[model samples]
Target: MKKVLFCLLALGFLGGCSTKEEPKDVTYDWAPPFEEVRWSMGEDAVFETLDLDEEDATLNVNPEKQRVFSFASAMETEVGMVAPDFIFEPGFGLVGVNLHYIPMEKEAAETLAKLEAAYGKSDDGTWSGTKFGELNLSDEQVAAFKKEADIDKDEPVVTIALNQDAQAVKYQECVFEGKNAAILEQVLAK
Candidate 1:
């Protein structure tokens, strides 16, 4: 009786000690809907000035080479009449999408003064000091911009051209993270 009881207790303890099965890994291979999505960068009031090469300016981005995407729209909207979008290719775990808007002629001085106070200085030499027009974004600012743009920090970036009206031309870029190919597919679908 003692032996039988001991055996039963051992079996019960062993059974209780058995390990649970691990969960199966999930694979995501289906491509995202990249074509159907079109994100608006808001109105021209928020953009800046950029110089770009007309011949090579397009959305298709090459990771190995340096490319310039410019947004200079609303040339006639206000005083200084300048709105530029500048995007540089991916580098240093960072991607840039800069917006520059110069108020029309009548407002250029005042607008520039305001911008200088807020951003820094305009690199265009329009200002005696450092050019605030040139963006020197901090890490926090970059992160915020990425969040606003819905881009992942780990992804490679692809450029997109928006707004081709004679008055304004805007540029955008898609930055991809690990396995972001799927996200790109989704963005292209819209």
Candidate 2:
């Protein structure tokens, strides 16, 4: 059931495709992942930025090579704090980082608007982020998705994005743990 939710939240938000408007040269005060890390840095730089050591991270079984550093509560970003799995492609070094973060309302809203301005909207009405603006969610879904404490309050958010070779990211589910145990098994390092 949680896997269903995770799969739904992660893979399901991508609605049918359609033609896109020419993107504008928009910028946001926020950034994807981290400015310090950005998107594509060499493995050495990534490991250094995250201060990762073999003792600190375990490699994933993925053919391309992935390392999970379970901060569950350490890293901070403009949007929110996140625990991340830094994925290093054999040659690409740091191509992607699978981040699990609870969204910060004001920041998410602000960035979402910026992304919409730049990429315009999908046929389905979702906006596009430098990644996918698929963080789109109905209020009800957001209500249901938040942790119990967040219900009715709107104090947090959960977002998930997974893609290979650092393409556009699609995400916006707000919880992990028992609810997402199945995917976590595959994504989380030992």
Candidate 3:
């Protein structure tokens, strides 16, 4: 009877001393605020928030065409996910932020596979799953497109790109007719 009481008391004490915690307040919202949204905000805003410096980066700009600012090497910056070799364009009114993953490499195939599964496939093998989504490429187009984009050589590979844009923000990589774009050009020119 004493042994039984001791065991019961010990169990009760252990239970009382238990440190089972309610989950920590760990949470992540894939969707940030509209203004805080990557690429949906101004270029300076993005660079500021991400703690990136344009001057320290390798700048590739065409005053009359496109402006691409990339890090000398892969670095962690927040957006859809942490990606390597970040590329930023002023984009018109706050658009055109691209995260280049598996740059000039072949590991992006796994990432693309996951995307394909989530988004599903098109008859041509490019994802026709959603509107305003990444342009799907047919198998043939994949290789040729990479060559055209200078993503890879000798073989067709996936260079996973994440684009953040809002409906209100106009695409400006080619048009180059917006005030914001003009300002970017001026900055890039210097």
Candidate 4:
């Protein structure tokens, strides 16, 4: 009787340990906003400028004639404000654009994969992902992440992080369409 009782107790404890609950799926409906402009050169030609604030740069393309122009600058004051870079390809009608700002290379790659899974393919080849949440972080996690990442307090970190990340990702997606589509890939990734 003692042996049977001990075995049952052990089995109960093991079963309880194995029954960890899965994480809940989180959803967000907010999106980031970007600016677009139109430019004209010397002649009768008119060009459109996709001013992506995420990367602090602009892409000028003449879709009718199939011409491309790029301009880039470094970010100075604000966190998301960085100069942009442009690459020109004559034949391809704005194939893609991508901007990444994650400190770790591995994190950046993981972010990209999450984005690809969510949106199919980034329109402009740009994407961003940040991790911030209500869950209390260990001292080590906070210290390690803070050394290179911009972790804000007061506001929900996950929301802010996702917004920043969305800007870059949407910029790439909007490269061809000239319209920004903000999607939170991080929540899904987690």
Candidate 5:
């Protein structure tokens, strides 16, 4: 009886120890001040509200290189902070938020954790700073999807991108789209 009881206790203890806690749903309180102008064609508010100096914000609407407009800025969020280069379509709203934050170890780790939890593991079962080369998650797209799916604000769908280099341990880009899975899939294809 003593041997049986000890074995049972040990099994129970091991089971409990091995169990992994479910990742909590992610919530976002921070969004670009001019998010509403997204997807709006010919909206000057996109540049007007950026509050960035003329030189800092670069507008290169060249179709050859697929460049529209790119600007560098820091975005603060509940999880942490990210400094990304904002890319947008000339007339339409934002299309990409490219970030390179490897020097800031703590902030990068926190950002990675937040993305992993919110995304609930990548389809391929891989985890790296820049897992996907370039990711796109548009805020307008996500919001529309959530609304269509009947998912409320309480249960959010956060979107972020990761880029990994074979030889480099540091992550080059971490893009966070407000709330869109379809857009993410579309941009990740290439």
Candidate 6:
């Protein structure tokens, strides 16, 4: 009877002194913001954001065309050293940028496949499928990529396209917000 009582008391004590803990607070809406050289940002702001070899970077101004261009072997990407051109206009400020020139030696399709595995393929090309930063993201089962890189709704989101003929990925960026793209189109047209 004493042994039975001791066992019962021990069981009761063990039950009372439970090791189970309260559930941890889970974060749901955690997404990173991708803000850089934004729309309408001036030349100084553009330079401030870029990590360039300032000694090599050259600024060319055409008074007749009212066009300004800054370019250099500014970035040594995973592929190779690339000269990214930053295009600006007087009133339009920092208008556009031609960046991320992947060397032809690196197969663009192979490069794209790796990105697609992590981010998923978009209608246009391989995209970071966070629903354009709109939906619930998986935070990636394989990797930590839950959503697309974050940017303001009004900011320009750069996209890459596979240039099969060239065997390269093209970095096309228009540094304009909303209907400003159309405005740029009109300017280019002129």
Clashes of each: 48, 5, 0, 18, 5, 2
Candidate 4 positional error at 92, Å: 24
Question: Number of the top candidate by lDDT?
Answer: 5
Residue 104, candidate 6: alpha-carbon lDDT: 56
Q: Write the per-residue lDDT of candidate 2 for residues 1-190, one digit (tens) a residue.
A: 9988988777645543434332233222222345576443565776677666645555565653444344444466443455666655443345445555445446445544443453454333232232112324334333333432222222112222221112224233222111121121112221
Query: How well is each residue in 1-190 modelled by candidate 3, as lDDT tens digits?
Result: 9999999999999999976532222111122212344323455776686677868766666564445565544444332122323333444333233444443224334434544454444233232111111323334443433332343222212112222222324211111112322222232232
- Candidate 4, overall lDDT? 0.35
Best by TM-score: 5
Question: Stretches of candidate 5 above 4 Å error?
Answer: 1-43, 61-68, 104-106, 117-159, 164-170, 176-190
Better of 2 and 6 by TM-score: 6
> How far is 104's C-alpha from truth in model 5 (Å)?
4.8
When 1 and 4 are scored with lDDT, the better candidate is 4
Report per-prediction Cα RMSD to one decimal.
Answer: 15.6, 19.6, 18.7, 18.5, 17.0, 14.9
lDDT of 4 by residue, 78-134 (tens): 223332333233322222222324444464455455545643455544433232454
lDDT of 5: 0.46
Q: Model 1 — which ten-residue stretch has the worst lDDT?
A: 29-38
lDDT of 6 at 93: 62
* Candidate 5 TM-score over all chains jointly: 0.42
Indicate the TM-score of model 4.
0.22
Number of clashing residue pairs, candidate 5: 5
Candidate ranking under TM-score, highest first, comes to 5, 6, 2, 3, 1, 4
> Which candidate do you rate higher for lDDT, 1 or 2?
2
Better of 2 and 5 by lDDT: 5
Model 5, residue 97: C-alpha shift (Å) = 1.6
Per-residue lDDT over 12-63 for candidate 1, one digit per residue giving the tens place of the 0 to 100 score: 9998998853332223211111222112221121222222344433444546
